[model samples]
Target chain A: MTIAPDRLSPFQDEFYSALMQAHEGLTEAQSHALNARLVLMMANRIGDLDSLVDILKTARSYEHG
Target chain B: MAYDYTPFPYVSPPGLTAPEARHRVVIVGAGPIGLAMAIDLAQRGVASVVLDDNNVVSVGSRAICWAKRTLEIFDRLGVGERMLAKGVTWKIGRQFHGAEEVYSFDLLPEEGHKYPAFINLQQYYAEEYLVDRARDFPELIDLRFKNKVVAHEDRGNHVALTVETPEGTYSLQTEYLLACDGAGSATRERMGLDFTGQTFQEQFLIADIEMDESPFGPDPVPERWFWFDPPFHAGKSALLHAQPDNIYRIDLQLDVDADGKAEAAPEKVIPRIKAIVGDKPFRLDWVSVYKFRCIKLDRFVHNRVIFVGDSAHVVSPFGARGGNGGIQDIDNLGWKLVAVLAGEADERLIETYHDERSHGSAENILNSSRATNFMTPKTPIEALFRAEVLRLAHDQPFARKLLNSGRLSVPCSLEGFPLQTPGTGAVPSGRAVVDAPINGPEGDGWLLEQVQTGGFTLVGFGDVQLPEVDGIARVGINQRSADYPCFTALKGLAIRRYGEGRAYLFRPDGHVCASFTAPEADAILAARARAMGAELEPSR
Candidate 1:
């Protein structure tokens, strides 16, 4: 199955800069907390259940440590 | 500490001593929903005969959390101010994890709305208000107590029902039969429809404790406090809500192994109350232990027999959706039934009631079930997810938004509805009319009060000209002497909401049916017809 990317990521660079700035002086626990918060915020903005489920599956589809 | 349970005078009914003329509408059950349904019907000029097995209001402080939208609907039904005066208004909710505050949210941060985010009034008071309001329509509302519906059959055009009165049993007929008969509905049971959904294994002890002292310390503003893992109830959820007359509703999640009988006893409940309130003097006003469920019928409309309120659907109490959702259903269905009986719209208009309300009910069930799952995890993995969310909520604003301690009920938008004429603005088509303070012919009133005056309203902003449409009331905002009723938006809230030179058409139920940058006669007529569940004509 293919899901075309339709997110408003035109300001991806600025968003990324702000995201990094949000965790500038945070420890490991604080950084993880920030990321979790970011994920939750983005998920709420994208309220469609199917889209959220697909996004979750896509995120888990990759390998991470 | 207990409320004085005033029993309504139950006069014995004549049942079918002599076959009376067919009732325009017959509503079974005189609970809040049934009473509201009758009142809504009466306001739309349709009379109803209300039958109830019992002649009293709810005995307990059940369904205390009346949502803002429900209060708005209650306003239209002529009891909003009374409920507001008697109810504890609260908007902020605090969520705690293990005796530590994780997050808090304000439900209605915006202003200019008439009702608060939520009002904690006992269901008995709500029923009393509704019943009293129903009495105002003495000619329209025929309330029969101790008259129980034993059997009913939808006879295509009408429903023939068997009634059992205190005197004797008799049969009668009604044009439209509304089964407002609650969750344990005898009507639903007789229909052989399965009311099935998620029934949790975890039981909750619901108790109303009467005390003058505030558990949250001095000067306690009424607010909801939900605990994911309070110290008193480790690993379980606890909830506290303030109600009118110094009564407080406390719900503690009980283990599946917990005895229902023992948990309800004062000896056992008092200890749990002590753990939470700590030596606080309180009397047990009411106590019950039960599991919650989310369930609904496949189809609400079956010929002339229609199911309203809990007879049609039920959701977990966590979200305050049960009574609130039923009131919304009554609000949605009342007008269409009025039109159908009056021959203004086709009987198909009644189907939209099912279509739109089923959507609302399903969303309520989904949200309530999700909240229930988060509160009572059925598995270790689920519990871990909930715990992590709560922990993350302590530090992350986004996670706090994700914390769903039963997201309080709101009016469901009918977006993508067949009736809606789409547009762009704050007041979108299919959305409920947002209340704004306005200076009408009378000193002052809310937008909803004005909207409640007439049939489908065409609210025009700033000299927007509209074509003459029958059965459509025209209201000019910020414009006077325009051959229509005019209102000066006191704070310019209504004008700002609809934008300049734009017109929004609201359905009879206060939902926006269409919006027009410029009012077009043919288009407006088409939308109006479609709102009545008639298909659009090809010519238009």
Candidate 2:
């Protein structure tokens, strides 16, 4: 799915930019290291993604129906 | 690869003596608050020492409920994921009167936070997580366990502390001292600060038990379950909270005639639980009695030493506000301490910690007292009122407001002061922006999210230029989207009324320092300077 620029928000964009920057100019091993950090950071920052997904899905479904 | 070594002689003997080596800041009590301060100072590259009488982080469950704000603080320290993993996330709470279901509320429905409603993790686990994280910065923080502060003298320039450890007594001098030494703070007592408030005549017995019959059923709800009436007793109620693992925290009302005090015996609690849940067998893991009291110190600062956490003020645990309030206290004090130590602000800036936190503590105390009054009714009239309110909430949305008032944890605004810039419109109170996501130019999440970045945040709705305040960041967001997802529907009108063209200056701990219609760089800087006790030219 395509990420909306506005939907990402400036804060979310900054986080995404930081994560992408960490991945740049890295060896395969280094990229993996940064990826692990990003995963944990994302998990902590956006807790229980399933719940958020459910929320967004419900909102979308209600709007459509 | 030899490290430089220098042995300093002991300054004080066994009891109390003047500190020989002066530190930038000295934090008393190695509990969560002290550790949090150490982490905050360490992030700012300031050196500090955290002293505690207990050698190890606590393993017991002193506090179980972790608020959304605090989870964000833990996230900044980079351990929030680990905590979230181990904790139980709850959003819905069921309130019952005897066997009759009165009303229920969904915490998650009121959305703007990126974090969940709340997490139930033992306090000891949080402390251990912090202690583990602190290992990365050994130089920035000196964790001295089993070291007790026996005496302290506030010299005009610095505070002299006398600490006694098992290794022998020693004196350490520090530029400033933070007393987070619990409710019966020795430092506060020694400094002659009076902690005045009303103590409930009734005592509550709290037990963490493993039970076969789930009082809340098997569905799992994050909201606090309250049973208002019982056949055995008229006014007595029981509070059941689902903690991590198979553990459940049960708070039962005790009769004045019970054989022993509530906390003294485990047997005192089991009978009460059995009376409510019938013959449900259970094994008690831990039990204690809490004497509910709503007390605040008249002043939070005594000389160069400032109080934080339970040392400064304490609230009734009915609302689970004590630990959350204490952590927020450190969040308030941490940034100011950083500014002072880094020479960005003056030492007088530390006084705001006293001014702002004291107010926050008083509010929490008032909220907790109100919750306690509702939970355990003292008079028949009060009981009738509480019953009617709960019953009405089942039908009316307005009635839900009274029940939900104390549940939501929102930061208090620092508006209407000379230091803050007053705009033409009214500033949103706690209710209006209660569930709004911590959003601005920086991003959208909870207030703790911004604080985790360990710097000040400038939240402006309209086109406000970024100010030149040191250690502060500015974020400009569309006023339309400022309403948080969870609270959008709940407070849409309120946000529109008061939030237009406003700018809020949030401290690293997430409380607002100064807010304005437009960014007033001079006023904001001056307020920060005053809070940090920094030397800045007066702005006319």
Candidate 3:
């Protein structure tokens, strides 16, 4: 499965901008901390163990050795 | 238009000349709470003497938000309609993060309620209207302006008060000394009571500005607008509310170490106002800089001398809970005190006021405190969490609930209280009765108006005949002609809200004490007895 056209609907660009804006003036460590919290919150929003596992495996495919 | 601050006449009391007879009740402070307390008692055929140091209504627009539950209680006290007409009605609240809107909510989406979700009116207008309403019962409510309670001693059976008036000092006695005195209560101080809770370090500059144009801009409907890190005031919270007489209330969060005097000065305030309104012609009506505290007495009912309103508890203004919570305290205490005085119930019934309203005040404090903490984060981690929450709130539905702009006042439920008999229905036991439109033989009316009488009431919905009980009024909805007052539920909203074929028993304060699917005469009596504190007796 690939990213759907409606992945975040019309808010795709807006959401991405907001995500970047969240780390506007934070240090690298603080940015990483924010990313960690964001991932946890998004995972909580997704709220499905099997689907989260599938998504985790799918995201791992993008990582190159 | 500015409100005229007319001072009420200061008439010296009879006690000034000679020792007056022991009164039934004495309420300190003639603010909204004390005046409303006196009016509520008077309506219940219990007379009270209201004393106050000041002769005027609240100076500024202190508590601008009057919630629906408070309005219903005010309606019973005779000033609800007057306020509803004079105040700006609003239900929608919008929360913003910086320049972007995060979340919005409709407080009362559905209709059929007599009053709206919330109304914004100057506290002075409400107090003035209450004073006018309090005058309707001149024989019952003795309003003595400039009467300061210098000292009070609880004398087992009664309270002895030393009041200083413009004429001279005088001695008075009362069966119950109700300390409706506000946050800085002299009465509470005299009693040496401990008021414990959290006080925030952050100070807010609240100003009421008048302008011909709406700050909400072009074709604005009055709504509560809250912003965090708003563009005008970066990295701080601000609130805008519309009140009567073209007055708009704006609260701006100030730095923890901001000079209170400087922030409240017109020089400093004008630029802040201009920053938000942008060259819009506006006049500053009132401005004050102050921090908020969430505090309450360990016990509201302290023997013969009981506390009500701010004297009992105080909360931050975040949730509009401070004033609304005080009004709820009056609603809970007034009926119980009247019952105890009239011998309809044991004195222990008054103790339940402490049990119920203390719980209510605690709930308000908890909510308002949490919102204040979220807005004014003490730690960097807390700020991070809040910022992330606001960011997610703009998109994720689940994240919206995490936003703490102010919960807004709703009637707290007393479901598990001892006075309430557990049952199943649309309105749960021990919750405030929901208002619904109805038409009776005489004319159209609301369900709350009929049920909120000064005595216990039984509302029979569709074929559930009201049981005949002494001292309890009966009303039927959508029931065929019998004996008691019957009404057709307009649009069947009453029947829908209150389950069909169910009998709801309400206390004098309009809270559902019990509900029955199959109501029995003996069962109804037992429940009434239980509500009146007979349940506290070992014989029961």
Local distance difference test values of all predictions, in order: 0.85, 0.65, 0.89
Which rank order by TM-score, best down to worst? 3, 1, 2
How good is model 2 by TM-score? 0.73
Off by over 4 Å in 2: A1-65, B1-20, B211-214, B231-234, B257-264, B275-281, B379-408, B424-452, B459-505, B512-540
Superior candidate under lDDT, 1 versus 2: 1
Model 3 residue B453 lDDT?
79
Tens digit of per-residue lDDT, candidate 3, span B295-384: 999989888998999988999998899889999989998888888887888888888998899999988987787778778876565676
Q: If the candidates were sorted by their DockQ against the true structure, best first, what order would they fall in?
A: 3, 1, 2
- Over 4 Å off, model 3: A1-50, A53-65, B537-540
Per-candidate TM equals 0.88, 0.73, 0.91
Whose lDDT is greatest here?
A: 3
Q: Give one digit per residue, the lDDT tens place, for model 2 in B1-540.
A: 111222222222323344346788889987788887788778767888888877665545778887776776667766678889989888767766666665676766755555676788877777877887777797887777778899999998798877787667778888889888888889998988788788877776777877656766667455678766655545677777877767788776766555446345755566766665577777777777777888988878766788888887787776668888887777677777777667766556666677667877877876677666556555444444466656654544444444422344545455543233333444421111232454434444543443346676666654444555666776544434423222121234324433656766665655455567656678778655443444433322
* Candidates 1 onward: DockQ, in order: 0.04, 0.01, 0.07
Name the lDDT of candidate 2: 0.65
lDDT of 2 at B301: 71
Worst 10 residues of 3 chain B by lDDT: B392-401
Q: lDDT value for candidate 1?
A: 0.85
Candidate 3, residues A15-65, lDDT tens digits: the string is 533554577677768877888998899999999998888767655644441
